[model samples]
Target: MAGYSLERLNFLVVDDNKHMRALVKTILHALGSKSVVEAADGADAFKELRHFPADIIICDWNMSPLDGLDFVRLVRTGKDSPNPFAAIIMLTGHTEMHRVVEARDAGVHEFLAKPISAKALYSRIRAIIERPRPFIRTATYFGPDRRRRQIEYKGRERRKTVKQEQVVDQSSVGLSQAEVEALLSG
Candidate 1:
């Protein structure tokens, strides 16, 4: 919303299904996005990354050979990842809490259930455009800070980095909390 333009932003849609890829591409185009890249799976996405760095990545969590989790882990933690900070959105059918937690830990910025709607997609895009989250790096993790803004919370902060409060560039390593809020609100 502040400095993002769909027509100017690059998007990478990763899925094993052709129809799903086409569907996402259509939605992106409708939103005025002109640069949309399609990847059949994580491997394909990895290859695409070499050619073009995406501003936003809409990927499915379930796939063959290279699943979304594997992809996210590699992207966020891989030493050779091109753009680790690129916003990642996981579009999947998995609705379990553990699965979502797994994805979040793998560095996914957004989680949208399958059978997605335009409103949900737009909301997520808006959130990323409006407010991106700070990136956090640790001995075992490299990605966006998983914590959301605490208006009021008495819960114990478990992560050792909770007190560090460090941030990295969006082009390097992390997902934005904006992505989660966008999907949740949707």
Candidate 2:
């Protein structure tokens, strides 16, 4: 981590507030990031993203027109998205757990509350570089896996077998389907 420099990485900062954007840019520059672009809104950010190669995106949640949520959903699910796997970090004052969940479900790779410090920002960037999460696709979601890692977890299987599931769904007495449904409904 001592030798890692962010100068080679490109970043897109999206926020409606000019002051916030500048503040983030300054922080990034101070942290050894030289290639940073600013966007006033998510739409502009999305455009900039297509034209520029961004390794990470630091964006605000609330914005006019295309907000951060919209931008992430499009990027994660859109057919013409430039890079579906681009790492994204949400930096905003909104600290509500539901908002964080929304951001995570929308495909954001990281979340940082407002009043961000240089150390925190640098730590997040380093974490992303060091331990990028694997992407997952499901019937209802498409994004990086949301599970928190357990240290030294060696692929323990947790899924139940088909026969086990079938047994659990039914009963040992071999009750009729209607009888089971009636008992469950009660």
Candidate 3:
């Protein structure tokens, strides 16, 4: 929070609870973010995204008409997606391993458990800005790479190399490398 400013970033907060939305907005505003949009549900979020071009999306897990998982899927793979590469942070009270796996599988970039704190929120945003994951395109997945580690691979590659393309370009959605380094070092 001390090193970087969120003023250059645009954010979208999607949640079914009005209070929750307000709380998140307060946190974002306090962090120097002036461009924060709110959506009551995933459907509304999509509508807002069509015009907002959010740099990061903070969304809740449960909502009517469209849940967070479905929304993430659409944002990642839908033909009409406004910004498939936008970083997503899923906020939910469900801390179960299965729920986390489900959210990860649906293309969420970060998962934040509920009872949210400004510190936790800021940390998640920092992680996104500091280490943006490359997008991976496959027959079934077209979102950020699910892998989080760099363990050495001892086994031969099983999948065909042609079928997977790693998208490493982040110029359009985030700050340049120089900008990020300056912020982190400041």
Candidate 4:
């Protein structure tokens, strides 16, 4: 315990159940986070994101209004706005491979099954922050010999853009600029 210390991380826990939210908040507090915000559902989560932007988001996948996948997609691809970068972890009860693939495609940083424990949450959070995912974009490299190489997101599908195409401002693409700014700051 000499060198071990809790990380001063900011977190947002989204769940429709009050008991579940409280449990997550307690875990976050035990982990040394001074700030933990709670949201009843995806709509509430989006509202919380607008104000108390979080460094990490742990959201239940079955909420009404927006649901976990929609939230992840909203924050990740920035639908109707700009892309935000806060690490997103989706909580789900299903272990289906297709579900996991869908989550990844929606830009989730990680997926966790239901009944999350403090140890699992902490470990996953540390791993994700230490080795954050990359956001790849296609670009044209003009060297002695002009050439173009497409950057891919590995497993995820992205807009196929031709080489040398001017990069569209992230804000101009999808999610609002304000939402993107909040995500970036988070």
Candidate 5:
């Protein structure tokens, strides 16, 4: 956290609740981010993405007209998508395992449950920057790799024909002192 900075990154925050959006923006600012765009829902978020060129997107799971899951799918596979490879973090109150799997399958780069703290948010951002997962493309899926850990598989090889692409290179970004302290002390 000593040598890294969030000053250069651009963020887009999409949530139905205005309060949540403001809180996320405030936290981003406190984390040393200087640029953040807000959208009320996923549909509006798509519009913002067309112009904002956001480096990372923090979006809520629940919203009217267009939810986070749908938005992530569009971003990952839509023909009109501005950036299919943009990092996405899904924020939600639902902590159910199925919901997390659903978000992961929809192309989310990270998942942050509701009641989010600055430390949790900062850690998610840090993970995206420092340890970007390679994108996986298959007949039915095209998004960040869903697997978070690498384990030795002693079984048969399934989907050997699937192609995995490295979309984002490993980043050299670091965290701010405040973020480091929050992560360490918590």
Candidate 6:
């Protein structure tokens, strides 16, 4: 139900391929996302993040300018944390074991293989949003506009920052516990 509501999220789709970026924006719109922003690559994504951080990011992995893994790391460890602590879903053509492992290590919340299917995209989006995990564990998690006025009006407020890195379970991507067991059994 979380992802089923259009009123819930503002999304960002980052991919080097123009068509793919457009396609993702279209899909998110269809899914009822309030606003969808597109970025050509990770650099453009960083600019967008600075201006208005998105609730979710669906990015392509093999980009000419700043790959998806670097983007994920940047989001996870950046000084000025991006809004909503974007739930990142990496889009990749390669499903090679090493590539998948590398992506997981780099902090991607979900994976959507290339030639994106609607079902897969919806599944991943819902998985990330509907999960019980806390979205962000920081005090200063709101947008700059909102926080700026608050800072100006309320001089100083105690901010709680968590040092621990969020590690999402691999099984949460799309595979159910039983499905993982079955895959392992085979």
Index of the highest-lDDT prediction: 5
Predicted candidate 2 versus true structure: per-residue lDDT over 1-186, tens digit per residue: 466889899999999999999999999998889999999998999899889999999989899899999998888898989988889988867766667678889998777777778876776687678766667677778887676444344686532332443322111122234423432342
**By lDDT, highest first, what's the ranking?**
5, 3, 1, 2, 6, 4
lDDT (tens digit, per residue) of candidate 4 on 3-96: 2344666788998888888988898888778888899887778777877768888888888988888887677555532226777777777546
Worst 10 residues of 6 by lDDT: 142-151
lDDT by residue (54-157, candidate 6, tens digit) is: 88788898775688878777787677656535778888876665676677666666777777877778887777666634443344332111111112335554
lDDT of each: 0.81, 0.78, 0.84, 0.65, 0.85, 0.68
Which candidate order results from sorting by TM-score in descending order? 5, 3, 1, 2, 6, 4
Off by over 4 Å in 1: 1-4, 151-186
Which lDDT tens digits does candidate 3 get at residues 75-177?
9888999999999999988766677778888898887777889998998899898888877778778777776655456788654563434535444343345
Against the true structure, candidate 4 has what lDDT?
0.65
Off by over 4 Å in 4: 2-7, 79-83, 137-186
- Comparing 1 and 6 on lDDT, the stronger one: 1
The model with the greatest TM-score is 5
* lDDT head-to-head 1 vs 4, winner: 1
- What TM-score against the true fold does each predicted structure earn? 0.82, 0.79, 0.84, 0.69, 0.85, 0.70
Weakest 10 consecutive residues of candidate 5 by summed lDDT: 166-175
CA error at residue 107 for candidate 5, angstroms: 0.6
Q: 177, model 5: CA deviation in Å?
A: 25
- lDDT comparison, 2 vs 5, better candidate: 5
lDDT measured at residue 104 in model 1 versus the true structure, 0 to 100: 85
User: Looking at model 4, which ten-residue stretch has the lowest summed lDDT?
Assistant: 140-149
Clashing pairs in 4: 78-175, 79-175, 80-174, 80-175, 81-174, 81-175, 81-176, 82-175
